[model samples]
Target chain A: MRQDRSSVRTERDEQFHDFVAGRRAALVRTARLLTAGDTHLAEDLVQAALTKLYVSWPAFRRADNPDGYVRRVLVNVLTDERRRVWRRRERPMAQLPEQPGPARDPATGPADDALRQALRDLPPRMRAAVVFRYFHELGVEETADALGCSVGTVKSQTARALDKLRTALRPPGGAAPHGAASHSVVLRQGVSS
Target chain B: MMDLHDRLDQFAGSPAHPDSTQIDADVARGRAALHRRRVTGAVAASATGVAALVAAVAIAAGGIGTGGVGADAGTGTGDRTTANGSVGASADGAGDGRVRLVAYTGAQPKGFTIDTVPDGWFIQTDDNYSLLLAPDRAKNPGPNADPSRDPVYDPQSFVGKIGIMLQSKDAHGVPEGTTVTVGGKDGVLVKSRPAMTPDGSQPPADGDTGWELYVRQPTGIQLIVQFWEGLGLTQDQMIDIGAGVHVHKDAAQGVG
Candidate 1:
């Protein structure tokens, strides 16, 4: 019996290792979006999620959609961290400057600035919904599953978040920013259904 | 002129070249967590009532003794030497290869107080919720510097600095880390590993070896004192600093 248990543990460990090796980069990518370009926080979130995933490997491996399970865990960790930070009531840093436009990131150009700021401005759960639906290209149902929210909530949050992004990306003097025409059309398609 | 979705995809960016260090750290931390869970489970299954509580405390003590840099067993006299032969017990000043701690003379912050701070570090920001300490360097703006001009040096950035605050309300039941004693009160210490990529965007990599020590206050709130990895403080020194924390009654309870 002990041998059986040991062998089971070994098998699970090997599977967990493979899962981590394969999914870590993508996980970090998603986390980077969730954290709105805070690389360290993104990495920390991913590591923490991965740690929890490792502990629940047997159940995770048995799931019908393991990738969805992984996404859920990652989102959970991110929101949990945010909740802790909020609960502590001591913000490490002030909110990004209350400028009209997005904060500058050296890695991105002026065009990408607005998108980054728009995402940062969203509440954590709302931002997660948008990232899952748009960046990860997950459907609303999948996004809702990953977010542990109702599909209706996902739609509402994504729609509201996209509206904010649209406004933020709009150019001064009421001119359409780059790709505004096409994006407006896409947003119509994205939110209507 | 990219579509918004395309723009977001670009903004999210591609993952960097894989780092084995991260994967390895994940597995190691996972295993440690599993081990802890199993130990706790076994303890719960084997005891009941006060016996279980006593066992839990023993387990915590044993875990800390084995998991951390071992209990200092020092006199708490402010003079014992650490493994590196630096004064481990002294919170008053730094020694060779040791972080210096000096009596904090700044106006008392709203939330917390400490008897000693690392040498040359100053209270950069004093809010009801947190106290920030930054090194006294030219580049770092003095306390209450304008954020408009020096966003990087803004105390709220919390980058490359020490932070002291009360633990979040939700963290009350969570076991923070290895147990230790600070000024005769129980404390917990958690040390974070260095980031795989030391990019400046990260909080601690600029010079922090992340260490967070939580000392329980008489009011039952845990006062958390965290150091940037860059400070290079030994565990003994961390305890010494934690020993000096006083959570003011006015310190607001963290919201959750």
Candidate 2:
């Protein structure tokens, strides 16, 4: 509904173009992470989000921080575009789950493999929460604001998301409790905090 | 103190730049939508909802595979506690009760209702596929952006992508225990360890295998049942829910 974007009187379409052109890669990457590294699906998600932003660009441009508006759109598209499927025709001749470790080839790369699995293990929302919070380092309030929720909600999502990440990344065994919603677990790269 | 999460989050990436064609294409889509209407006073948008559904499920059901997945029907989707006791619920509202499927309004054929998804949770569906999105906020957020509009880019660039495999299956994996028919195809249900990966590469040998239920629902379409991690339910639990996969006998008539 570009018409909807036309409806908004404030933000110039040129300004919006600059805005989109600038953030294109980031939006795709974020969508990629949310879609568990599915680049094909990730592109679709980004396209969907851009369309939404185009519809609301005028109104959103008037509001504070249009980038945040678009960011919300990107995240929402990934979260909302849930029914994406990739089909495989092969019967169950023999199947293997992709290793949590790096692949033999360099293109797939070790970091990419590990990171992909870790991200894939997260629930969509939790994944969004993690990407938005930790990757973007958005504050609870900012994350909530971008996501159109309260700060408290952001806190709990972050906490729960951290727990899920821990579960996925941790060796298959028992781990400690995630404590309470009031606190958040700050996970570092090689060493977990 | 360093906790499990801290180290996990720190699982850093070896950054390499990805091409920007998709961004260009996204921009083109938005601009085309805008110019189409602006130039022609009409907009013929690509509602991939239904098309994507057909492709997603059909291709996904027949997705690339080199092995059979071991269905650990005996154990869990993740940590056992995360199932019942874990997965902290929203303290507000009526609490973490079961979700109710509200109305049907996707691009799919008419007259179908699955289980009740929670409120606040948005529905993302096509003719053959569907997903209940729990917003990063527990409040169940709405769709991110309007499909018909152009997106404003983030300066940071499209750095990553996320993939989700929503699977449903009986104890035996697929076609054997439970069946779900969507669209018009009687898809042969198959469940095996999905070879999912992020970098466009295959997964390792030891990753947790998902229970999949494959069927042909739409015209020339198949269905694949998968979820985020594992669905903590047992074989019995999955069967219980899978029993409700609504199949319209008449609609599924021509499906092979």
Candidate 3:
């Protein structure tokens, strides 16, 4: 019996190590977006989620869609952290700044910093919706499932989030001419994915 | 113009130096957490077994003595209402709503000092944030349980325990109940649903009711002494317990 327990522990640890090696980067990236570029907080969230995952590894191994389970834990940890007064501090810049690319018209959207700031402005769950839908390219239903919310809630939150992002990204001159069209296009892109 | 996806991608730029050591750290932390859970569970189980054994021994020796308990120790479904209309009842045939608050002869925990504890109860878990007074039969989670994560943290372990802690930082609005006094300071004796039931996150299942005594300290921090219905303590006893609770400087201030 003791030998069996030891073998199970070894198998669990080995699998967890492999899971971490294989998926830690993607998880960190998703968490980065969820925390609005706060790389430190993103890392903390991933670490916490990984720890919880490890604790429940026996059950986790038997479960299907392990990635979904991990993502759900990650999002839950972020939201719970958001509720804590001690962790309610401001988010710092993402560790990796945006790379310089072809310049876009300033009137069309906000700069990278502006975009990060806008994402940070959103409520935690709303920010998670935006990240899952846009950044991770998850379908609305998948995002809803990850968020443990209804699909309609995901749609409304994503739409509202996009609206806020669009508003925040809008240039000093006026609303962008294609704002409405862009909104519809974004929703369609999120849904059809 | 770049779409939302494109912009998000650009914003979530690749990490400059993704530390390979993080995986090791994650594993270590995970292992430590797993160990803590196992240790806590084992300790709680051992305590439960010992308590059952002691109870059986006491029953064999005739009966359990309530040395410091109140005089109205009738073994019945003692359900009564306070004059102020707060729900009062008892469970486990302990007593009616009324219970004698005897001097808590146990070791005083940090953050808060209690002059009185309910009969057959002691400070099971204590921290600078809160103090948990648990009955002798409770499966004590030892002193390591975090009160900040109460109700959700080992739900069954905390059931029927009296919790004393400061009001959360974001706690506002006067709780509706009868006004009372504790240690010469104004307090509120409010009846609330048990934050956690044995089943799960559900509150006060099977008509279970709890009590909360919100006593205002001189420093304006309201101390809350919550009584689980299983204790069957009356509001007056709750206030008596609240009166004995003295907050110390070491007590950590609550956050939302």
Using TM-score, give the best candidate's number: 3
Q: Is candidate 1 or candidate 3 better by DockQ?
A: 1
Across A43-110, the per-residue lDDT of candidate 3 in tens digits comes to: 67878788888888987887797767877888877865664322111111113245332133221123
Ranking by DockQ: 1, 3, 2
**Per-residue lDDT value at B246 in model 3:** 94
Please write out the lDDT profile of model 1 over residues A44-141, one tens digit for every residue. Answer: 88878877887788888789998899999888888667643522223533333343221344332233565666677788888898788877778989
User: Which window of 10 residues has the lowest lDDT sum in candidate 1 chain A?
Assistant: A93-102
What C-alpha lDDT values do all the predictions have? 0.67, 0.45, 0.67
Candidate 2 ranges with C-alpha deviation above 4 Å: A1-17, A83-109, A112-115, A171-193, B1-24, B35-256
Candidate 1: C-alpha RMSD to true structure equals 12.6
lDDT of 2: 0.45
User: DockQ of candidates 1 onward, in order?
Assistant: 0.19, 0.05, 0.18
Best by DockQ: 1
Interface RMSD, candidates in the order listed: 7.7, 11.9, 11.6
- Report the lDDT tens digits of candidate 2 across residue range B121-164: 33332122232223224233246643233111111110010111
Could you tell me every candidate's TM-score relative to the true structure? 0.52, 0.42, 0.54
